[model samples]
Target: MKQGIHPENYRLVVFKDMSNGDAFLCRSTVNSKETIKWEDGNEYPLIKLEISNTSHPFFTGKNVLVDTAGRIDKFKRKYAKK
Candidate 1:
């Protein structure tokens, strides 16, 4: 609702979910050095994401654990009752 406070450089950008390899095109002002050819055969700026609506547990209604570098195991070992 403010004037001159919004970005005027909105451009089509492809957001790719690394977890599910899902990608979608949307307008964004974020900068990226990578580009991807979309389904429409048009090149767009590519933005790699670790998780998105497609692969997110909250959005997909699936309780999944994504453990990296043995974090879950380390937590269990540290907090486990002796």
Candidate 2:
């Protein structure tokens, strides 16, 4: 591990899986404007995640399509001209 390269602002942050609405607390330095009241009665930075292990197809053994941002549309438009 490299010294002085690691962030010192590591703190407990709540990550909510948007697909399953699952929330979990973990150490992170990510910034979030949202705050959530945890079961411990404390507020923590809320980070919304589109997918996590709880809802991921690889982990849950289910096929799912997560189209974030209009990536598919952009891909088609860019290649359609060719």
Candidate 3:
């Protein structure tokens, strides 16, 4: 265990999975301008996540494809042959 090496701004933050609307509260130093009322009736910093263990394919044991900003479509269009 090391002292003064860890972040001093660790606070309870809400991590939400946007794909499935799943959220959990945990300590984090990540900054967020958004806030969410948690189940415990407390307001915490909101951190929106594209993929988390709740909705990730590997963690959930379900194969799923996540497309961000239409990257998959862009790639397909770029490689599609006439």
Which candidate number would show the highest TM-score if scored against the true structure? 3
Candidate 3 stretches greater than 4 Å from native: none
Estimate TM-scores for all models.
0.82, 0.76, 0.88
Q: What's the CA error at residue 26 for candidate 3, in Å?
A: 0.4
lDDT of 2 by residue, 13-72 (tens): 999998788999999999999999999999999999988999988998879766656778
Tens digits of per-residue lDDT for model 3 on 1-82?
9888988988999999998899999999999999999999989999999989988889988888877568899889999975
C-alpha lDDT of residue 66 in model 3: 75
lDDT of each: 0.91, 0.92, 0.91
What is model 2's C-alpha RMSD? 3.1
TM-score of 1: 0.82
lDDT of 2 at 72: 84
Better of 1 and 3 by lDDT: 1
Give the range of the ten consecutive residues with the poorest summed lDDT in model 1: 62-71
Q: Which structure is stronger by TM-score: 1 or 3?
A: 3
Give candidate 2's error at residue 77 in angstroms. Answer: 13
